[model samples]
Target: MRDIALLAILLWIIFEAFRRPWIGILGWTWVSIMNPHQLSWALRTMPFAAAIGGATLLGVLVTRGRRDYSQSREGVVLILFMMWISITLPFSMVYDDSFELWKRVMKIDVMILLALVLLHSKRHVMLLAWVLVISIGFYGIKGGAFTIATGGSYRVWGPENTYIEGNNEVALAVVMVIPLMRFLQLQMQAKWGKLLLTMCMVLMASAALGSHSRGALLAIAAMTLVMWWRGKNKFVTAVGMVVVAGALLSLMPAEWWERMNTIKTYQQDDSALGRINAWWMAWNLAKANFFGGGFMIWVPQTFAIYAPDPLDVHAAHSIYFMVLGEQGFVGLILFVTLFTMTWFTAGSLRRQGARQPETKWLSELGGMLQVCLAGYAVGGAFLSLSYWDLPYNLMILAVLGRRWLDRKEWLKEKPEPVIALPAWLRNWFRKKPRPQALP
Candidate 1:
């Protein structure tokens, strides 16, 4: 029955995608974030994402959708980054292992391109935002409730086989979406809708704190500060935030605090030490291999050769070092440049949109996207989620919002068209209105 419902959704989305290309954007974003198939034992093995992706391609191709969509220059940098990694994969220490990772990344890149090609309007951008917020917010709400119930003892986990499968990863992803939730709340007009979104924001923050992840704690603090600074109702929101934080902290067990305390005492923590060694190994790999060691560059051999403590092989937990390890200096530059480009685009679009009354939503969107990116920047420093889908989708929104504002009616004010009065009205007006032409 669960499988049937899942399949039904897939087919419906496929139909919608055929009808409107941007609908496919929502479809894949749902699959990427939610991992719904991972919910049921019966449907656990289903290749739902792959099926939907294939259907999307066929639907778009057959429908000839997005014929007039403008491709932004941001995409070229992403493609270049992907191609560079693909080229350098053969040089990787784990060549066979890199193929699977490469394929996974390629799929994500395909989605990114599809997004750029299809997401043309502000409506599409908001719809995509809704999909992301609701999908991730499901876990956020569930996890927050569970945290309250369990006294913040159990960890929050995402659906299996996704980037956010771990407690820490889910917390970080949850942190990232809070700003989007706030953005939605701001966009909403109805009292009930805004109230509901505000609740979601609180729940998601609870879930992040409940994850008991030290890195997530930092991320939550950073993003919350940014949001508070930019958010309206500063005093009320700040008080509410403090209340929620206090409640969550009181619920958290002592061990959670001890675990978090490792942040200040990382020198004494083995996991922290392992992560540092891994970061060092990445830098060494970048220095040695011009192309870097490709993805998963911190394998045993690389560790043996480069790590300060070779016995403890660890994942490159930092995004900066992860790229440096996997893609070398050139790849790192391209990778960083892509994010830098997105950031600047957001700032530029926000500044431009501020001058226009109609496009103020774009300004709101840009400001919130920056808050989201700040989460990734702070959270990603301690996690190896460089290839995560959420940030990329946010980047796509920033880039598209920038482009759409430039080309569309959102910015340019139109002069109202003059029309001759209707026959009956004209006769009446000619009799009554003689004083209209004031200098």
Candidate 2:
């Protein structure tokens, strides 16, 4: 029944995706982030993501939507990066692994293209962010509740069989979601909306703590500082952060603290040493294979051939090293270029949009996104989520923001709204001087 239901939904999305590709994108994102079908006993084996993505592409083509990409540095660099990857795929040392990874990347790249083509205005961009926040925010809410219920004894994980399957990934993802949620919180008008979003932030923070991942701990700390600095009410935000963070830290057992303290004593930690070994292995592989050994190149065979200590093999826990090992020096550079360009693109949008009263919302959103990007940049160092969709989506959002403003000619002489100053101030200089003299 679950299989049938999910299949029916996919069919509907295929039929609807052409007329409304945005809906298809939402459906894909929901599946990708929420992993709802992972819960379905009967539908667990289905290739739903690929099928929906394939249908979405066909729909996009059939509908003949606009495809004019921005001439921004981000757009050009992304294309160059993809072109480079295509050139290197066939030459991969791990042929089978590379081919599989190539197929996966093709799907991801198409999602990015859709973002570039389909999103025309600020509404579309906001909608994309909303979907992302809601999808991941579900786990955050659940994990938060779990943390409270368990007294922070057990770790909070994401839904089963997804990218955020482990406690560490869940924590990183939740940390990233924090700022996006704040973006939504600010845009909301009502008192209740503010309260609810505030609660979500608190719960999500607790969820991150519950994960007991030291990397997550570091990520939350860094992300919290940025959000606090960017926040309007600095004192209130600071106090809330200190209280919540302090409370969460107090709840952790001695073991968790001991584990986290290992960061200072990393030289003595075996797992830390293992990651160092993997990093060295990646360096050696990149040195040998100019084009890279290929995706998932951290296998024992490669480790045996490349690692300084073949017996202490581990996953390239760092995104930088993973890309270097899989795609080589050129790939690493392209990947870094894409990230750096996107960061600047978003930063530029925030600055430009902030100057316009009408576009201040975009600026606010951009600030929140920058915070998320920072979390990913830092947290991702200890994790292997180098190709996740969130960053790419954000990059495209920044790109779309610039294009949207350009199309509207927003920079040219924008009229500011009339101020509603106090009546006393308006009359203060005119007649108040005479009244004061008479008194």
Candidate 3:
């Protein structure tokens, strides 16, 4: 039954793609982030994502209209980064493995470019955000509830056979979604809506802690601090953060505390020590090979030459180190430049959007994206999420928001009605006569 339902939704998305390609893009994002197919028994083996990608491309070609592509330095840097990785492929320590990973990365990057072109409208941006929040927040909400029920005894994991399947990866993903949830909550006018989002935020935070990830601990702290800094009311934000942190920490077991305390004494922790060895290997490899060792450089053969402790071979646990190992110094430079420009661009949107009521949501969104990026930056240092789609998508969102503000698209758009009502109801209100004043 679950498989049938998921398959039905997949077919509907493909059918809709021809008329509205942006829906396909949103569908692709939902599938990728949520891994809904992974939850189903039969549909798990289907090529749902590939099918959606093909449909979206066909939709783009079939749809009749002038479409715009992003022409920003950020986009240029991303493309350059893509080209650099391809350049390093021939020099890859393991050619077959690296080429396979290259294909996957290219697919992700191509969709990102397509998204930038198609998702330029305000409505598209909002829909994309909704998809991201709902998809990732599903885990966050479930994990939070699970934590509460289990008293944070068991660790929360992401969907099987996905990037965030590991405890640490899902924790970082959850922490990043918190600010997006907050941004959505702020857009709500109804009291119940606000309360619901607020609840989700707290639950998501609890879920992050419940993962018992020390990296997530640092990420949540960094994310919270940045969110507070970006907030309109600093004092209230600070107080709220403190209260939430205090309450969540209280729920954690003593074993969780013991695990986290190892951060300060990383030398004695084998896992921490192993990560350091991997970082050294990355540093040594980059220094010798200008283009680095390319992808799949984690093998014992490559580590034998570059790693300080060759026998202690491990994956590049840090995003910085992973890129440094796979793509070399130039790739790392491009990677850093891409996100650095995006960070400032988001800040620019936040400042400019604050000046008007119509664009106030942009201000809130920009601030939250920055918070998300901060979490990724800090948390990514301990996790190998170098090619994660979420961060790049957030960058595209920032670019789109900036484009809208710069072109003043709101000026051309019809003002959204304060209250949408049925025609009959509106006509009745219009025709109804007012009572005479008592003279």
Candidate 4:
């Protein structure tokens, strides 16, 4: 039943794409981020993402819409980084493995470029934001409930065969989305809706803490401090945050505390030692090779050559080191520069939007996105999620929000209708009294 339902939805999305290619883009984002097929038994092995992406691409070709991406600073730097990686692929120490990984990265980049072209208006931006919230929030809500039910004894995990499948990865992902949730909450006018979102934020935070990842702990702490500083009602926000942290920490088991305590004594932990070994290997490899070792460079052979302890083979747990090793110094420079420009751009957009009465939502969106990126930048230091799609999509969203403000496109979004009741209830009441008037 679940398989059939998912297939039906995919088919409908494909059908809709021909008429409105943007629908295809939304469908693609949903599949890429949620990995819904992975949750179903029969559909688990299907190439749903490829199908959705292919359909979306075909839709783009057929539909009447712009196909070119803006050559913004970030976009140009992104392309340069992409080209540099391709150049390094040929020189890869593991050519076959590198080619495979390169293919995966290119697919994600292509979708990102396509999204930038299609997602232009405020409606498009809001809809995409909701899709993002729903995709990530599902795991957060579920994990939080699980943590509560099990007393935080076990770690929360993401869907199988996805970027966030690991406990630490999902925790960081959850931490990132809390701000997006808050952004959505800000756009909402209904009291009940606002409360629901506020609850979800708490649950999502719980999910992150439940993962018991030491990196997640640091990431959330950094994210919380930034959120408090930027968030309105600062003193209240700070107090609520502190109270929530204390409560969540109190819920955690002794074993969880023991695991987190290792952060202070990392020198005594084998996992920490292994990650350090990998970081050293990445640094040494980048210094030795012009384009670094290319993809799949975490092999024993490379470690034997560059690692401090040749026997200790570990993946580059840090995104900084991951790019440094895989793409070399120039590539790392481009990578870092792209994000630095994005950060400033988001800040500029936030200030611009805050000054305008009509564009305040953009202000809120930009601020939350910065908070989201904060979590990614901090937590990602200890995870090898260098090519994860969420952060990149978020960066694009920030760029798009800035574009909207620059072009005065806020007029495209109609203000929410004023009503004493929801549209559904209003319509229902209106229908019952209309028969007498008609007669």
Off by over 4 Å in 3: 415-439
Clashing pairs in 4: none
lDDT (C-alpha) at residue 63 in model 3 = 97
Worst 10 residues of 3 by lDDT: 413-422
Those runs of model 4 whose alpha carbons end farther than 4 Å from true positions after fitting are 66-68, 412-439
Pairs that collide, model 3: none
The CA lDDT of each predicted structure is 0.83, 0.79, 0.89, 0.87
Ranking by TM-score: 3, 4, 1, 2
Residues 2-75, candidate 1, lDDT per residue (tens digit)? 77888788778776766665677678889888888788777778776776677777777888655545556678
Q: Estimate TM-scores for all models.
A: 0.90, 0.88, 0.94, 0.93
Q: Residue by residue across 69-146, what tens digits does model 3's lDDT show?
A: 748889899999999999999999999999999998899999998898887778777778888899989999999999
- Model 2 segments more than 4 A misplaced: 1-10, 64-67, 409-439
Error of 1 at 339 (Å): 1.2
Question: How far off is residue 182 in model 4, in Å?
Answer: 0.4
Q: List, residue by residue over 274-373, the lDDT tens digit for candidate 4.
A: 9999999999999999988989999999999999999999988888999999989988898888888888888887889999788999999888888888
- The better-scoring model by TM-score among 1 and 4 is 4
TM-score, predicted candidate 2 vs. hidden true structure: 0.88
